[model samples]
Target: MFVLDANNPEALAECLKELNWLAADENIVTLTIPGAGNMNCVLRVDTGKRRFIIKQSRAYVEKYPQVAAPEERVVTEAAFYDKVREIPFLQGYMPRKIGVDVSNKLLAIEDLGPANDCTVLYNEGEQLSEETFTKLLEYLSGLHQQFMKNKVDDELENEEMRKLNHEHIFKYPFMVENGFDLDTIQEGLQSLALPFKNNSLLRQKVEVLGGLYLSKGKYLLHGDFYPGSWLQTEKGIKVIDPEFCFYGSREFDLAVFIAHLYLSGQKEDLIALVADKYEGFEQLNRSILNGFVGTEIMRRLIGLAQLPLEMNLERKKTLLDFASKLILNEKI
Candidate 1:
């Protein structure tokens, strides 16, 4: 029942000491938020001698406190780190798991200092470099191919978080009255989003994809794989924050990746590169991937989880129409 508070250094130090993550005499030099995060309480802890990250998932989301979430999500993230430790390639692209306090829902990880997340891509004029994209895909491809379970069991199911995500990604965005005002995000966005929300066929197809997202599959997926989870560090494109991960379709992961490319206004060639580089891309169910991709795009625009997209209303409408086509299989 211990809560993490960056404001209270005495309490944090005591908790860290009790968990053996910090020495009795280790003084906390400073505690600062590493970057923009939505799901969990994350802070960069500097002991003057060294630095690391401490993350905890509370009963509600860190960004939207009114929204409820699984408290043990950080534990699942820790498990993901443990699961991928043997994979040398994946290890290189992610922060190392240092320790975990399951009861308190706290985790300590190696700090990739001054390394900003790729969220800047969402801003104007910023682009996702081909090199970074390739490294990210390679990490994701390896994660799906390796470290897979034969049959979907209860391990790392993370159903609570999945259900929470299911609402935002599938159900909420399309609702005519989800209490979220899209126009607040943009002047004409709500009016533009109305057509998709009211489309019967589009809603039906999106519902089918939502079921697939909930269903268990053979491959382990990094549930939230957008640019937000990627870090552009000195080493390369280091991936972080797999709290929403589960044993699900690899298509969901790849679909989210491609969706962000389109959202960020990345060129068609870079978007097309996914099919060429992803291992077994041809073998995947293209229809399913397209559905997920379309849903991701729509949800990001119309749903509660808004991105810092520097796009105009006209562009959003175009993307919304394009997303509808992907959902309905009218377009690739």
Candidate 2:
């Protein structure tokens, strides 16, 4: 298997040729890194005539090599695209699958030209409008409803990716010393770990949620549904990065989505509107959803995979307090 990067046009060109994407005379016009996903090496490749994305996953994380990952996760991502293609409402919201090379663990997909990820909302203090939020909820509703109470494709059941994500989302943030420098991200932020570490009740709740995350196989889920996975394009919101897709709690996706909205400083009513508009899943455990939301907030705020939020120390502490209450099933 040949490796390709932004600097290696020759390797990429050869790859395209092997995939039959490049004609005999055509060459790559430009190659650039697409986004901040940690799992894969995603590149935007532009030939003079057309553009597409080539994503390849390795045995370890592309962003953090020390963290081990399974190469087969890319195969699972490809399977997710295939399964969703049959669902009419979800077809338009996802990128078109062009080709997949299982032996090399690479995927060629249609490029959503000039679209930016929703992470920019947090990084730049932009807000998701009511209309856009509703659209997102609609997409999620369709996805959850389509597969609810049904047997998911065995090929799409991603246990390795879920275990990897489970560690990050459920276990790591509360650790006193996880080698992540919170002070570097923001001065004195390391002090915030005290409350989480000392609170036995909070840790117990997290353990319960983690158990459910691992054991429950209720509905098919886009396991890592967050701002980074959502793209804002001229056409509409496009969901990506289902490498962590699995059969898990339906509320897990919804909780993660709304947690980012809160962290991005969206209005209370807007957040409430999203919750009200969500018509997915026949049964939802509000307490469990709240626990997942709180855990997601904690992880993003202090875990290894950090977001570019513009919150000060005091505001972060406030959010942390709210997250704790939510996890404890207390009214906020």
Candidate 3:
């Protein structure tokens, strides 16, 4: 079994040879870290001949070591790529799986060259074009529609990752006092936690949504569908990081997409347009969808997993208020 290390060129060279990614005479390879994801070690391996990405999961989060994660999540991620390969609409949008090292718990896949994550648009104060949003929504709707009522593969179910995600999205943000210091992320942010912890009605509403999130398994979902997971390239938009993929409500993915757009300061009309264009599963629950979106907005604003948004304190307060309204089943 060969283990890959981004820091050691010699080890990477040996790994390339072991994986047959390098010819015996071709030893030169370059490695670079690509993005800011917490869970896995993602490295881009460039041989003079070609380029590919090697991703491996750590037993604990790479960014926050105290938080434990399942290494088996890589197996589930590889399974997702395998499943999508067969689906006509989802074929090219995902990276092609090159190979998997189960003992090492690593996956190697095709690298979409020189693409930027959608988060860069928000971070740089660039606007998301309507065409991009339409394409994204259309892709998502097609995925949901294609897999609705279809048999979910037992290996692809990924219960462990789903439970882990549920805690982050549902339970952690509302904790009265977890060791997580929101103020460290930004001063005075801890004050926001008091209201979320003390308000029983708000807790009740969140708990209700949490229940729905746990029980509803209507369609296959790209569990973490935020801007960070979306990539823009000369070719088209490509979605990545489905370690959290699972059988869950289609509404969850839609809500997550909408919440990130709202936080990015996209126009309300544009947001409405994107929502209207998505033709999801029959009789989707608006309240539940709104509630999920509301929770995602609040969690990102004050929770442990934060986005790099360029918003002032006053604007954050306004978004918090709006999030509360959505959570309470009130129209925003």
How well is each residue in 1-332 modelled by candidate 3, as lDDT tens digits?
45557788678777767777667887556888877767888898887788889888878787888888888888788988888888867877878888877887888898999888888756646788888898888878877877776554454677767777778888888888778888888888889667876778888898888877776485878888888888998789988988888777888889999899889988888888864789843468888888998999998987788888888778888998899899998766
Error of 3 at 14 (Å): 2.9
Name the candidate that leads on TM-score. Answer: 1
> Per-residue CA lDDT of candidate 1, range 1-332, in tens?
98888898778988898888898889788999999889998999999899999998899999999998989899999999999898887888889999999999999999987788888898887888788888888998999999678877888899999999999999999999989888788888888889899999999999999999999888989999998899878776789999999999999999999999999988899988998789889989989999999999999999999999999888888999899999999944
TM-score of structure candidate 2:
0.94
Off by over 4 Å in 2: 123-125, 151-155, 280-282
- Tens digits of per-residue lDDT, candidate 2, 76-159, equal 888888989998789788898888889889888889988888887885558888888888888887888787665544545677
What are the lDDT figures for the candidates, one per model? 0.91, 0.84, 0.82
lDDT-better candidate, 1 vs 2: 1
Candidate 3 residue pairs in clash (backbone atoms < 3 Å): none
Error of 1 at 206 (Å): 0.6
Looking at model 1, the pairs that clash are: none
